[model samples]
Target chain A: MVEHMGAQFLLSMTTGIFIGGAAGYLGSLMLSKRMALVAGPLGHLTLPGIALALLYGFNVSLGAFPFVILGIILIWLFEIRTKLPMEALTAIVFSSGVAVAFLFLPIEQAETALVGDISRVNLWEAFVSVIVTSIVFLVLKKMYSGMVLISISEDLAKSEGMDVRKYNLIYLVLIAIIVALGVKMVGGLLTAALVAIPAAAARNISTKLAHYSFGATIIGAMSSFIGILFAEISKFSAGPLIILTNTGIFLISLVFKNRGRR
Target chain B: MTNDFVLKVKNLTVRIDSQNIIENLSFQVKSGDVITILGPNGAGKTVLFRTLLGLLPHEGEIEWKSGIKLGYVPQRLPFIKDIPLSVNDFFKLKKSSERETKEILDSVGFRENLKKKKIGDLSSGQFQRILIAWALIRNPHVLLFDEPTTGIDISGEETVYSLLARLKQERNLTMLLITHDLSVVYKFSTDVICLNKHLVCYGPPRKVLTMESLRQLFGEEVKFYQHRHG
Candidate 1:
């Protein structure tokens, strides 16, 4: 444990835990929908926004927000117009975002954008993220069954009175918000892993979706807490450590599943 | 619209990718009609169903009776057997009441014990019944089933057939079923629509399913064993 629980450290930690948990829960839906790799490219789509944030010396999420939203909207539009698969559309935006980001990104500031510095979080940012996380959690919980119903059968979902395209656009926007907040905890390159791995672990042992969904949140929060704490103690890069911690939890979950099966 | 009409499609045309999948297709259905649609692969049966459901934009009129609940069993088999949802969780995606879930499950002959079983672990037969159950729980006035040839219980259709018949008998549901199976039409369909981009024929299956119609809808070598239907 750290000798001192400084206020700055606590604020960053709280925001990290909340974002990690929400991302993990969102990832459960992504995994079930068979779009697990979506978050990775969406992370890459955040680069242009993060670069602008770094250039302007503002909160990184504020800059990342608009760009991620633009990318998601474009992906949605192209998905309808071209009828291309979502992964292909996301890959298209990912490349464009990265290429655009590098046009004016300073070499010295590149590392911070690529590998985030959570300690840069301010009290106001932390508070905003907390509120956003709670609202996302509740709204997602309401939409959870409806969204999963769409994945099960779009026709069925439509018959149930869901507007599939509208729900999908809204779903993408929610994902954008989470991805924007995620950049500060694990940076653009590793944010997908942060979202995906915990959900994967939770699925291993869960029979019901409620278990899988809630379990992912807990595992996600645990990984962020342990990873960030250890990083602070060891002076290591938090992003890589957080991902490694997520992987460890996934492996343990595999073992737990095997044990339960036997 | 007729007083007891369940559905009416007038000059319906659906264009996708700048190509017309369905063109000037028209049909009407009564309250208790079981209309079976048959055609070879690439026929617009599925497209017609989607157009009627208002999922796809169409340049014609499709109408359902006001305040009628619709349940659709999609054509493509759901590859959900590997996902982490229990059967009960799958039902919970729509209905939340324990009593309703149990009632729906039992109506389809689904064992109560299997409620906790992962949907991914159920046999295709069980899953198919579950899909039927999922649709039936809504007490829909009509059911649309897109029946593909494979990925369901290929060894037998007895359970599913009986379950569907029983449910329809009890509820007096209007049905629109799309299938490639001729025996299904012989056994259960009140009316059959033969389609291949245009309406080939539409009437009682006995008169409408002549060999000439089959060859026209399918290809020159088309044949079927109508007597084997049971």
Candidate 2:
């Protein structure tokens, strides 16, 4: 029994690290853009999809993906066609998603959708997780500077020859991708914490841009590794433990925060 | 079609919803000209700049000679004021080498020690310097500035204008700037475009904007609007 559990956790830990690291790296930019809270609504928007996955007994992330993609497209379109900001558009779209979710949510298996279960993955699932996480990270790394410039000044970014709207569409799509993959490691409810806490912690202690971005990845990976290990040792849920471990890192980061900063 | 003509605008109109922000606006720019755009607040000064940069959907032509690089210093960014972005990181985003970034910052009169300071922490004068530095990093044939010295101290404001003049002399860079101060128009501008949604006046600064015109402009709502916007 112990041997079986160890094998299962090896795959869990492997997949969890990449997802957490990718989420953390993306979160670094989102935090800088002041759109970190947006993931909570985006996550909530995945509930209808998660409910569909639960009812059909399919993989949960698969169910969550379509809803999130749709919601991001709506937010992206609304942002372009109207003058409303991303936060307002996201709230308007996702609250409706959450409402639609409860209309059909299966009461019996809702726990799996609400608080994620990482231990149940097979080898194929682990491989897919690793590959998707890798692609997401590379794409993000390529456009990181362009996105940063946009955050500082959109007109400046445009004058520098960046297609601001194209970059923004890519940004929204990447968030949808990560949120979908993240739903497996931490459920829809906790996805925001998964993305935000590590990046917030990195912000406190880092004085440079590169340091803040890369450090968030390391912290995210470390949190997932420890949380999964502890979850195995005791019988608590992985979502809360991972988020708790990340929260601990955030608290400790306060002590070492550059004293000159607020 | 002349190579000397850097920009040609033919009846540009920008409409959002039902209202026309800028209507039937036409102008031209020549190479190496320091054109000042003077207007009361909400006279579509910013909208004109955006239209020139091709950042807005508009009706009519905004023609820039092909392959002319453009740099812009916008009026304000209320969002970035609280974001914790350090000076070095901001330059790094422009892909400047460490030495290159240092040299540019020094040229703009920003000290080396302040490199570690978050841009949010900088005073308005310092932040204005940083914006100017960022715009200059990549050499551009044309620059569009919206109230470039609005927040700087009066003494610092003169220095900023002098630096722009120096760049204009050295590089022959074409500059178009919007200013609230009438004195700026008289002191530095080669040509002036006085705008109140449409072209109010257009000619050499001293030629078209004389004391009589200045008094007329200041006598009306333009005076009230300038103070409130400033």
Candidate 3:
């Protein structure tokens, strides 16, 4: 299989797994907190960054980083100031990002920018993905219980002496990082699906948090690997294919959910 | 300063968006006392509770005896029904052992088999009991209940109150409870605090829950229900 696939395809597959697993794990937390819908807007918010990066001839992830961080900060601040739900704040930020993106990006680069073309991934991008993914996993592992407790009830977590605001900020930063890294491979439009779908599927079948997280990671990695392979064979874009694979998994998990209910 | 005092709040005020939700509230909680807070809707009952727990920002002195362990049961768990969280998993948030979880559940009258059942599937009474069990597992010195029996039936409410009373006696735990029902106040509270933004009155249920105070707190629309004294 290694001999058959080109080097770029192999690198893309590896990058996809790392990004997908991290996204899936983070997605589980977001889903548990009912902030899953926020992922889509955050993903879309990466567009201006990618556009700026394209215009400036810099790394797409680097360009997306500031905007993603800005988006997180704005969302957090607006949530505190306006007391609006995260979904609403995300909508406001995402629309602004889209409007800004259209100003800088050439129309020709829009397709690849909207839906990522992972064949352009280099060795540096692959290495960065691995490093960032490892950091995300470690932080998530340490914060998992505390985050879950906060999700259950902020007052309960506070009673236990956990700093809920600090953890929430950390969580948003993690999401910002993941969205920045993911937009190049999954595209801004479909990146949130990479985060959300696996977790959605995992929760349908999992009875415990550990199982849900592990199931999400497995499904995500598998989808990325298989989706990349299928795209290579079918001459289709890998980003949309990966999302389609995750959607399929989500649909299948609903069966397990319904069965368990009965 | 008494050795029996578990919590002390003096001139506590909580303001949000320049509006005071709780103003100049002062109260003391003694060990082994079930302090029931009574108020009408939007009377800042929940705000006061949150302030006492240090969940909300407030001014003035709010002190807990150093190193005192506290357990809390909110009026409702804010979980969506679609999530696949089981009762066992809910307990796992506290990192409780299986035996401990089982013991707590049994103590709260929840069957061990229900551990594997989804938390969303539990009835209102069962969920309330589970919340109680969640608190019990902590071995807290002070337990707080914010309308614990809100959605439960009348008989179920009685059962919950009885359970709370038995637990209070057995554990010698200090309790702070928020309730709308005067019957619960009459039956379970050792002290009652009538609140509408500020403290209306505070003392033993017999002295503080008189018609005038009730009228003052809830206004002319309030209806008083009499129950045989517990």
Candidate 4:
């Protein structure tokens, strides 16, 4: 039964499943850590990665890596050198990335930046995104306690002998890879939703944050699979169609959450 | 002839932004000494505790006699909006074994049924007991508590002190207790330090809480409490 989908869709599904799963897992951890909102700007911030790669003759993901590394370093340095929190650092670095991308990328690529084409996405791109995202998430899952502790109290996290700054820096670099891959698949505009919506929707209902993450993966995959179907049927752009499905789910979750309170 | 010092703070200075929280502070807590630091709010009692644990960044040396592990109980807050952690899970963070966790919780008079309850469901006093259990699990050489009895019941309060007193004697643990409660001040502590921004007095409780010093420290409030207690 599993083999019937053939290697193409099967591999694409593997790419989609794990990438969606990994994003959902890390996204939920970030949500519980209260860094869910940071994903938004960080996603947008990767635009320069694509643009710079085009200009400098490098892979978009590789180009994005340095910028994301810079962003993470800047946040840690700012916290150590100054005292700004991670959220504030994300905003600052994100804006800087957008500015640099705007300044450098040709105006012709602006439309490309706005609409990510998952349909045209090739095997190599999917393979790289899936592999990198999986490895990063695998590492992060092991350090779950350390990450959660940092979210609870930075001082306590440090006293526990886990460098909170280092953990955050690691999270940022992975986030950059995800954002870089997201630019081609979902486009920069909706990439943050790809990280945030699944997690947020799960959080509205689950008791444990871990459970919420699992739920997020299911939700993300379903959104992508169904959105892909709807886009194929309606002949709409896959990126926008996928995001709209996610948004619809988000709104429904919001209503259900409010009703649960009453 | 002496246990010397289990914990020592030498000329500790902490400046957050421009304001000084711990200003040129120096103190020593010997082995088995239960020291209570009395201070009003904003007097930096919490700051002092945080500094000792190497939590908050500070200047100057916090030299500890080797093998001096610390157990801390932070100020409690209402249940976090949503994050799942059972009491057992919380205690495990302190490196306590299941058997030790059960014994410590029982020592603090928590019901056996509550070992599985989520931290969010426990009441204030029950939660504080759980915190105490966490601290005890570390079997720390020094126990630093900031207002440990704030939300406890009267019996729980008595139990806490008796348990602390017992732990100090049995384990020879040194304790640094920061609290505003005067009733237990003389009863539980061997040394009392009157702190208001700086160390105003440090000696045996009777000498430190003299009427003259009371009037000097808190003005009229001390007189009122003294009269009420007397």
Could you tell me every candidate's TM-score relative to the true structure?
A: 0.92, 0.91, 0.94, 0.83
Docking quality (DockQ) for each candidate: 0.62, 0.49, 0.59, 0.36
Model 4 error, position B226 (Å): 3.9
- By TM-score, the best candidate is 3
Which residue pairs in model 3 clash with each other?
none
Q: Write the per-residue lDDT of candidate 1 for residues B1-230, one digit (tens) a residue.
A: 56999988888888988998877888899999889999888788888877777788889788889998888777654546445899899888886578889988988887789899988777777777888888888698999988856777765466677677888999899999987778878788999998888889999999898888988987843744433342
Q: Which ten residues in a row have the lowest lDDT in candidate 4 chain A?
A: A1-10
**Which is the better candidate, 1 or 3, if ranked by TM-score?**
3
Kindly list the per-residue Cα lDDT of model 2 for residues A1-262, writing each as its tens digit: 9899888999999999999999999998888788787788778888888989888888878898998888676765676688687778667766787688779997776776777889898889899999999999999999988888898778878867789989998998889989998888888888988889989999887767788889889988989999888988898988789999999999999877756454
Give the poorly placed runs of model 2, Cα more than 4 Å off. Answer: A77-95, B1-3, B81-84, B111-114, B148-150, B210-212, B215-230
Docking class of 2: medium
lDDT-better candidate, 2 vs 4: 2
Tens-digit lDDT string for candidate 3 (B1-230) = 67889999999999987899988999998888899999888888888878878888889999999989888888886653545678898888888899999988888877899999888878888888888889877699998898853568777777888899988887888999998778889878889999899999999998887878888998854654433332
Lowest lDDT 10-mer window, candidate 3 chain B? B221-230
Over the true interface residues, superposed, what is the Cα RMSD of model 2?
Answer: 2.0
Better of 2 and 4 by TM-score: 2
TM-score of chain B, candidates 1 onward in order: 0.93, 0.89, 0.94, 0.89
Candidate 4 local lDDT, residue A125: 67
Report iRMS (Å) of candidate 1: 1.8
Which prediction has the highest DockQ against the true structure?
1
Q: Which stretches of candidate 3 lie over 4 Å from their true place?
A: A1-5, A84-91, B80-82, B148-150, B224-230
